[model samples]
Target: MTLRAGVLGLGVMGRHHSRVLNELEGVEFKGVYDPSDAVPSHIEGKPVVRDLDTFLDMGFDYCVVAAPTIYHLEIGTMLASRGIHALIEKPVASTSEAANELRDLFTAAGLVGGVGHIERYNPALQSARQRIQDGLLGDIYQVTTRRQGPFPGRIADVGVIKDLATHDIDLTAWVTQQEYVSINARTTFRSGREHEDMVLAIGTLSKGTIVSHTVNWLTPFKERTTIITGEHGSLVADTLTADLTYFENGVRHHQWDDISQFRGVSEGDVTRFALDKKEPLRAEHEAFRDAVLSGDTSAIVTLAQGAAVVATAEKFVADGLEHRLTTP
Candidate 1:
């Protein structure tokens, strides 16, 4: 059975979804819908509805709501009401309450809903998490992430937290299986926009492990990197390159009475990892389709998970603002 998928909002990311839908085998690109179809036509045979109701009424098995953050609650509510499975973009809604309300609706509908935290699908991350689980890294300590780039003028709809940093926020916690105990952040605005263009956040996981995240819309060059430090070794990831570098450099402390003249030395090896041959977006969409077909929540980005990420981002923003007020 083919999974009929429709996408809302034909913007940058939405258009990417459309492209994947067209290329993905065993999936039907039912239609594409945006308020204005004035742009150069992309879909050939598929219908481009003037309104969303027609697309929803088409009885799509699953929908990808790539609309802006503010429209998430409204679009998700409508889809859930129709018993449609939807993969909404991250930071599920503009506010925590809104996220909760939509989550409730989905739970009541008993639908296989998901959030578009696409970074989780990255193959480097897939490999990293596998290594972590295999005890290769062994007891992770400090984790740092940097996702910075030129201002995404296209996404002025929300602050840096929801727009750019949400990916790192969710994936870090998910990979570690830890809850964010606290977040400290600092935000900056340069272009006189309502949202901050630069944000820096620090958080501690439940097991006393610490994580630091830095995201900005204004930078000299584009960058997406993650560094994980553990007891045995460390792993570095370049999301853009989809490359991984494992560093075995670590220090092992000895008891004060153990060494008489000097301590022994250890050398670490450098290992590089290669990513699989599929694009993350394609992998993510296919997972959504499979989840819809099987009603499996395992591959789905559960609403509670979305809420936790949003809550963490909100905390970062709050702390950032407070820090600005207190600092010189």
Candidate 2:
């Protein structure tokens, strides 16, 4: 049962999706649709359609909507109307309201829909989730994430929050299995664009876990890291390097066992787990493909989660704007 797969864009992420679909088993890379006037020479081998109608008529069982964030709703609507399942990129839509519409449309059509929160498929993150579930991290106290890098020429429609930090927001909730209760955020527009280029946010999870995120497009070096601290130890994952490490807490053997004596801090051992590293995007594509084929969406990011992440990001932007207006 080969699934006919199509891609909606040919940008950075879309190009990767096209290549992966071409190589992915059980999926035929039918073609791609881009609104741009000229298709890049790099994409010469695959079929390219500039017309939306013709692209929709390609008989795609599923399509990857890797287009810009603003076009998500329109593309998703078209796909859903045609009974084509879609895997939309993260921050599913430009706004939460639009995300809800896409979600409902897909749900009403009985289509297999998923958001491309690729971090959920990172080998390190996957291992961390399993270990946390196994009670290795104990009661999670806080989760901090940092995703920073220079501005990519491909991004134009969204800021750092939507383009990058949404990954951390969704990841914190997924890894902790908790809902965000509240959030406080501040943003900066260093690039003079309509949207923010950097953001610092602190969020509270339902279980009293504090999640902090520092995401920006101004950093000279790229870093994608997550730290989970709990009662027993801490789990750290580096998404770019695919490294999962655990730092243990040490207990000092005190000779002065007095009632009022305090034990000094002890540096513990660090352990790095060996993981079978693979491209997270490929894993995400596989998950979406399998869900479309099996009618199971337990492992993929649901539309509701996508909307929730967007709602959270909206709060961040709103708060940032309010703060700017209130400042002297």
Candidate 3:
């Protein structure tokens, strides 16, 4: 069965979603909905509807909400009311409250609502998750992520945490199969924007694994890395290149007494696994499409999971605000 799909935004992500939808198997790219006159009238031979009602009337089995973060709640409400499935972008809504509202709305409507946490579909991260679950990483101890990059002018409604760090927040919990129990953070707004441009967050998961996230938009280069250290070794996943490497703990004993006493775990062999390296966005769309068709949300990131990530991000922001230090 070919499912009809539409995009609700024409921004960077929206355009990419449209392209993937148009190319995806068993899916039909209907068109796009963007009230902004700035966007072109047509993309890839598909009409870009200027009116929301007219766009909704086009009849889509699922709609990808790539609109600005501020408009997620409003757009999600409309889709839910129309009994349409939706795959909203990350940081599900502008606020945790709005995210929860959308979650409940979709749940009540019995619609297949998902969040575009594309990192979950990264080949490296996907491999890491499977390996960790298979006990390749015995007894997870810590998870650390660093996501920094030059700010893109395309994102104006939210800051680095919401725009970038949400990827780490969601992927960490997902790869570890755990939930965040507590989090503390500190933020800085060096970019002169109302929202923060940098944040350092530390949290603990339900399984007692510690996690730290360093995210910012002031870097000169783009880096997406997640390192999960367990009793056996560490799995380092570089999402930017879809590379996963494992650093195993050395079994060789140190000869020197002093060196052996100080060294906790000796450096072992490092192996980078080969991955399929499929485009994460395409994989994400495929998962959502499968969920919509099968009526099983297991393979997709549900709205509830997205809401939890937003709630955790809200706590991080609040903690940062409360603990902000002043310099003299």
- Top candidate on TM-score is 3
Q: Give the residue spans of candidate 3 off by over 4 A.
A: 254-263
Kindly give the stretch of ten consecutive residues in candidate 1 with the minimal lDDT sum: 258-267
Q: lDDT-based ranking, best first?
A: 3, 2, 1
For model 1, the stretches where C-alpha displacement exceeds 4 angstroms are 40-44, 250-267, 325-328
**Model 1: number of clashes?**
1
Residue 222 CA error for candidate 2 (Å)?
A: 0.6
> Highest lDDT among the candidates is held by which one?
3
TM-score of every model versus the real structure:
0.93, 0.96, 0.97
The digit string of per-residue lDDT tens for model 3 on 1-328 reads 9999999999999999999999999998989999999999998789999999999999989999999999999999999999899999997999989999999999999999999999999999999999998999899999999999898998898888888889999999999999999999999989889899999999999999999999999999999999999999999999999999999998877799987787477789999899998899999998999999999999999999999999999889899989988779
State the C-alpha lDDT per candidate.
Answer: 0.83, 0.91, 0.94
Query: In every candidate, how many clashes are there?
Result: 1, 0, 0
Clashing pairs in 2: none
- The pairs that clash in candidate 1 are 185-320
Q: Which digits, one per residue and each the tens of the lDDT, describe model 1 over residues 80-186?
A: 88888888988788988888888889889998878889888888887898889999888889889999988766786788888778999888987887888877898
Better of 1 and 2 by TM-score: 2
Better of 1 and 3 by TM-score: 3
- List ranges where model 2 is wrong by over 4 Å: 41-44, 255-265, 325-328
Error of 2 at 194 (Å): 0.8
